[model samples]
Target: MQPAAPESAAPAAFSYTAFALSLIAGLALGIALGRLLGPLPGGEAEPWQLRAEDRNHYMLAIALEYHESGDAARALDKLIALKPAGDPLVALAEGACALGSGGYLADASGIAALRSAVQLYQDFGREGCAERLLPEAAPAALPAEPPPPAADARAQPTPLPSKTPPPASAQTAQTARLAPTPLPRRFREHSLRSFCDIARPAIIEVRTVDYLGRGVPGQRIRVRWGESEDIFLTGIKREYGDNYGDFQMEEGVEYAVDMPGAAEPLATALSTGSCYSDNRRGLKSWRVSFVEV
Candidate 1:
């Protein structure tokens, strides 16, 4: 009798949180750097003298373009070695990238986020726009706004609730409980917000191809994930799936698969998130399987 064949390893489960973050980081880095350089969608390889016309989004798009090729880990090296304060695109993409890379939102605050966006907007208009977008009075941390007091005349001044502080024991217990939680094991690590952030820095384009070495046109492949029943992000798979894999990218959408072998999906199944990704790139887990003619 023939010897039994070795079983294949089970595919790694994909983490929505992890991969999303990678893409975010990748795009942000790429954009920030590209913007610092100039006119980068396809203009010059690395623009030196920055132009006044360069938008904050230009470089971010470039980074997304970088991810279009997939492989976040590789893209990360490019991001780590950057000096991005001078350019607006660099700043904004870097901020959003935290979520795209999908692990930790890191230490950036909401005020920082709005400030970055505002700064870029300022570049477009003048001091007026900057005043509105990034107001001088804005708090550094920019905590959420407080609720307004009631205006009804009939509403007698209700007795204000007394501030009852928690017992010292309770406070100490809470602190102790939180202290033992490690960085990787925290609940915040697994949230959707963090996941999307991490993947942003890691996503690449998903192109399609056929058995032959020619570009496959107009074929729509669905990107489904094995980890969850939901489709990862199903969009019109790219047109230039030849060099890449059967796929094309939608603008702004990034694809990420922490689930190794979760790459190069074979068939579409309902369950995972089904939608289009920015038509630029994707990362492959499974070997590309071209549709046979």
Candidate 2:
């Protein structure tokens, strides 16, 4: 029977051609599918790709320019593009713009937003900025006198005699012409002594470091105390230790802190009452540092 036609022999030429065609068809199908799908939205240039410091600087610059130029609408538009919707810094900038633009001043929400921004800035140690955002106090109105009791129909008006000053003598007039000498005003120099007076329990120091244990600047640190929350930007005055984060804490209350851009946030807290009181504490603040591992 011709040795059963060698059962283990390779496939025919047609089988090889079929296999080659199948492989080619699969590659073509994959290419067509890829083209149909296209790239994902946002593509490779994603928001997360931006460094935190760069983003903050960019936003702050835009905010400052808007603050100077009084271009509220444009500033708001740019801020919206940056997506700092819930960020207090951006909110402060927005409030400044609104105050300049005049239109938003009448809106209740706008007023509330500015107030919130002020509080946020104050808590975060940006008191100067907060003060700027604060609205000017309205002047108090004087009480109006009641109209002369409707002309009493029966009562006759009485005229009162007025006293006139006697003619002044030449010597008396010369004395009157003399003005009191102006007194020199005393100026008090700014001092941190008041800050030093706070008790230790009320002071807290914060610092930040990178993976190398070196100081990190331009960090956004958020602290929560009881029902209140505050946020501060690090490195404003590097001379006072740019990486140092200093804040006052209420005695007996606990505080929690975190850095916004940290991959693994180094959260820490303190119970103020646990520490000893120091008379010089106000001048000396407490400190905490976030170190990347």
Candidate 3:
């Protein structure tokens, strides 16, 4: 029977299109499974990746620890690990201000300590508004010494000591007279100038200094526009003078600048109107200064 027609031996041809479709389907299934499983192990967020508020808290904790241990290097290392966008010192100081402004320092000795630690850094040129938000802590009251044990009534009383006024001298009088009470220091506007430049955009630049004209770091500056307000501190940008701080201004908007306890705003309303420089029109810029009076 013709060898049963050789059993019709013939292999089925492979479909390249079917292979490609199967490959694509497998890849998609793998991706879906990965999504359902979430991130792989050890994928925890880094300390630098913490949320902004959490990062502030982290900075405060570091400052408090630094206060207790006085380990500035360790504290600095820890702060650097946070990967702050600005100076670590400034970040620390801002954290202190945030804590104080947020009412987180009420009866919180730890937070107060953190603020004190930040102030110590301020002396080194690190600047922030912490001092305005949180004043220095008052000294603790000294304990009263116990009165000498009363002499026993039975013991004979000693003769009363003579009370004689010593001869008055210039030194004695000078010592006795209380030094004239010093007047409280206040800051007054030193200078205010406005200009424009094509290269530099509009800004409110503020500088604070002592009576001696020495740049004072860590001074707080407040800027209000519309209903919004912002505070900044000097010395945050060391490249600029330690007393230098700046705020960018939006075109056609007015802003008020002030400091704590000032009689009034430094600039009741500083308008960012147009100005000409180098024969080219541009937004206006301001340079204002304050000095201790």
Candidate 4:
């Protein structure tokens, strides 16, 4: 009653719940419209919107396709569409270098094919550090020796010779056969040379051959750089000759090449720091040959 408490009016409480509901509804509506309308005009397509790593993979796919189809114009157009900063060939080389350095050459499927395609492009006047990343092409399988001419099924055994030999020359030949003849050494470093060639940079070319000087396929060549080592077999690249297996070198690092049973490395202290060719620089290469002793 006390004059009706002066009817002191209280301000209405703010409706936080209503504000939050409105915000959520508006966001959902925007999303729905965006989905219906798709990407805005002038926006990049799905391929172009890929991240750097994904983009590289896309380029690799294009390369592989090109390799299979042998369509240069199509491949070039596809690569140029990627919006690479400079020459598309450079991008191809960079991708190849990345894959090689990342150990893709070790065992990944299709990696060799990708590298081969990249190398094809690299040969078109764009060079990168990918030359050495390429693995030797697999050697053609050797034909098995025909089973010793099947022994004649109907032939008779020959008569035994009389055991009355007393010749001095025969005796000397027998003694020589009994005496030990030194076995030829299995392997030796034949030659080593360092030079610069723009076409092939930072390459450590290895060739393994037999006593007859024919390429010895399946021979293993080891390359050592600091604490790391890589073993590659010859005959992988038939085009390079069956005896050939090459390794790529990194800048500022020393490398050594050796065979399994060799007394020492075919080449040591090999580096690419000083070798230069033409107006370009830094593609020092070495050639090492190994032969059966």
Candidate 5:
């Protein structure tokens, strides 16, 4: 009886505990992996990413600093990195770098860059900067030197065949069309100063309102000077003002501002009659309110 029947082992109960543990582990792993590959907190972008305007402004600063440091090569590199290769500011910087690279205005690259910058500035309503780069209109052509007094045939030295072709200096001068010439140090200093002057910010403000005296946002303002016109939009800039936009105005220049929604265009006089204390130098502005025509 004791040996009776080896008690049949009770069928092993299905392990719910093990199955639950495995499922929990899988879920934990999935969560960890998702977090590891997920985007950064706050969904932020790479810090290195730069906006076009920001990049342009940064390069201008670096280029200007390099010019002052007399580091022409570095200045040029900064300009080359600038976007919109056709930007007048970039062209101006390139021209300045070329000129400061011990070539003065004789440097062909510098002259070309300056010419391009001048045209772009004109097209962009930057007359002050453009005017500075343009050559004086109708500059008198230099008189041609009289032909070398006819050398007496007897006085001319007989040409002797040389085994070696020519001196290195003479060969270089003959082969290279653009030889680097030494520029006076003072000239570079002057050029850097002029660049600073031209590149400095001269902020101009505009505010638009409707006849009901309500601020008008998204109004397009066309600023005209000389033969150039530039359009900008109005927005609310914090406490600066609602329906406001700002532009940089060249010193001592007048501009005509037209708003399509306004009854009439506003013309800036010698004095806009309104100036503000802004970080930018020579801050001026115009306040326009539309009225029933």
Candidate 6:
């Protein structure tokens, strides 16, 4: 079935930059790279490289995430020894770099160069070139120093005020039980960074027909995000299809809202790989004003 059009109350403006991820998975590389790159053990870049070409995109991705979250210090630290990216991922990095630079990304053309980098990698059939290049990195940090000798070993440590007074394990369990469980959104899944703050909320379910209006299971359903990009979270599980339905969403999140005359929340959210994806088309992605209980 066709997915509804994308809509948003606050249109998210971002660069459509792409980058070559290492043929290696991000999780695998984090183990050693953290130390090798002068960081605490167990961090980003899993399945990381000990080779060149493979290291570029994954490094770029790490840099981008840090840049977007406004952690310039960390992002710069990662890119300190890295080379300028080529193709596909270069564009992706450019977008993240712009965000890292502390300047407003007024429009999509904001990081067009970065997007081209991702395309470059793809064009060369090195979609995930696994290059682990390490021409040189700064020297590792010094080991931590031992604590200073104390005046009296027998003295009891000063009592510290508890934060929130520690909750009893039993009480904590009870509170968890009382909280509303997040019913799984069967279609929630994403490949790229899905923007939870900007998207349409109209959730669409697709079902195939066997001549009867019954339900068709196991059909490929496409939910496109917005005009800015042709991102569609495709090949969803069929169980959720029968309910081509509406479900209320958490407030302060993006949604493809339900059509007033339609069955559910207007397809008001964009598609996250997991329920909502962030698509920036330079339109009205926000509400002028509205009251809600």
TM-score of each: 0.16, 0.31, 0.46, 0.37, 0.27, 0.15
Better of 3 and 6 by lDDT: 3
Order the candidates by lDDT, highest first. Answer: 3, 4, 2, 5, 1, 6
In model 6, what lDDT does residue 208 have?
32
> At residue 130, what lDDT does model 2 achieve?
34
Model 6 stretches astray by more than 4 angstroms = 1-49, 81-293
In TM-score terms, which candidate is top? 3
Task: Count backbone overlaps in model 5.
Answer: 0
Judged by lDDT, which candidate is best?
Answer: 3
Which pairs, if any, clash in model 3? none
The model with the greater lDDT, 1 or 3, is 3
Total clashes in model 3, counting residue pairs 3 or more apart in sequence or in different chains: 0
The digit string of per-residue lDDT tens for model 6 on 1-293 reads 97765776355574334223542455457856765775434444333322344444445465335423434445445544454332223333333333424332232332332332322332222221111111122122222333355568786665533223123574365334332323322322211122233345423333233333343222222332333211121112223443132232333344443222111332345432333335534222232111111
The TM-score measured for candidate 4 stands at 0.37
Q: In candidate 5, what are the lDDT values of residues 1-293, reduced to their tens digit?
A: 46555546655576788989999999999999988776764457432234544453454455335323445455545555554334334344333333434343443334433443333322332222323344555232233444465578666654433223334575365335322333211100000011122232345566655545555554456677888877765552435654567666676677766654332455333223233344434334433443222
List where candidate 4 sits over 4 angstroms from the true fold.
1-185
Comparing 2 with 4 on TM-score, the higher-scoring candidate is 4
> Which 10-residue window of candidate 6 scores lowest in summed lDDT?
126-135
- Tens digits of per-residue lDDT for model 3, 1-293: 45553534654487788999999999999999987785743557677878877787888777656544556678889989999766677777767767667776564454455555554455345545666555465423232344455589676665543433223463265334322323434688888899887777698899989888898766778899899999887777777876789999998788988876542587458878788988888888899998977
After superposition, the stretches of candidate 1 with alpha carbons farther than 4 Å from their true spots are: 1-206, 226-289
lDDT computed for candidate 5:
0.45
